[model samples]
Target: MRLLVVEDDRTLAGLLHKALTQEHHVVDVAHDGREGRELARSGVHDAVILDVMLPSMDGVEIAHQLRAEGIVTPILMLTARDGLPDRLRGFDAGVDDYLSKPFAFEELLARLRAITRRGAPVEDECLVVGNLVLDRRAHEVTRAGRPIDLSLKEYALLEYLMRNPGQALSRTLILERVWEYSFDSFANVVDATIRRLRKAVDEGYEQPLIQTVRGVGYKIKAQ
Candidate 1:
């Protein structure tokens, strides 16, 4: 899914980008509140991750403007201020959820998934490729009724491949999406994770769903 993240702090914004991208979600970030508002108004995003106390236009106003314009994109606000009135203001402005600063990424991810689910009532929570299944809501993976164990990074990489099946995903693209390091330095990370994925998903199976495109990267295709 594509997402919009509006944050002023460069450091925090970088962290958010790394985290969200690692989960295979394409993220667009705006450091200025006004710029962020413009991006939010584009309507290309599945959801918005907003930070309050922004320069030029605050988060509440951005939310208010988007809502006033009848843009119903789900927004999850992040703020250091956790006062009732602030929360009330945000809610009044059509914010879907709020998370205080210093919060856990797990909680943020949960809120994001929940709000996106609520925003799009018909969206599928589970992803399927052949008999291999990934239940995003439950954070579980199984192949042909057999449970598959994977680390978080492994799960994320597999999900990405499953999301874009049969495509020749390049090493640079996978590196950008799966890990938080530079492609030149972390090129081996993708290879390592792909090996881990094959061990977990193809070790006991007759069909190998994960395939390599020569001179490119990898893909997940059913037999």
Candidate 2:
């Protein structure tokens, strides 16, 4: 998954980026709340790990702004403030989850997975299109109950496609949602990633779930 980690603490931010990258997640780091808010508002990240005490805007305000703009990307607020009032404020600001400082890395991972899982209404914790199942929480994909491993970019692309199952998603839409402002129409990164995603998601399946709509774009649906 693509994640945004917002922390003013340089060491901790670096640590998180390294750890999450090692876990096969594409992580972008922001050292202050203002920059974090900008990135978050772009609506690219699958999830956000935000620290409350930040330079400039602060995490609570960032959350509030995101919600005000109608952005529903899941945010997990990290804070040293374990006080009930502080936690409550974070929630009121539209944080989906909260984790106090000095927390275990495993716990953070689990919470992130939990937040992303609850974003979808499907009860299985796995998105299904035909016989294919995408376990967002587990970061695993299965076809006919057989496991398929995907790269971080491939996983992000597939998850986006699955979330909007059957909708014709243009390449421009996919680029804006998945890669943020990093690439434009000239970038073939989207095509390459989609090719890889298609291979992993449809290679062995009897019917391909991803379909091209001539000049329009792509859509995922059971054939």
Q: For this target, which candidate reaches the highest lDDT against the unseen true structure?
A: 1
- The segments of candidate 1 whose C-alpha lies over 4 angstroms from its true place after superposition are 1-48, 54-73, 80-95, 99-114, 121-123
Per-prediction TM-score, please? Answer: 0.65, 0.72
Model 2 residue 183 distance off true place after TM-score fit, in angstroms:
2.7
**For residues 1-223, what per-residue lDDT tens digits would candidate 2 score against the true structure?**
6789999999999999899988887787889889899889877577999999999989999999999999988999999999999999999999999998899999999999899877455664567888888876567888888888887767878888888888998888787666654455534787788788888878866788888877767889844
Question: In candidate 2, where is summed lDDT lowest over 10 consecutive residues?
Answer: 178-187
Over 94-133, each residue of candidate 1 has an lDDT whose tens digit, in order, gives 9999999999999999999889888475445677899998
> Candidate 2: where is the Cα deviation over 4 Å?
1-3, 8-11, 24-47, 66-74, 80-88, 91-104, 110-124, 204-206
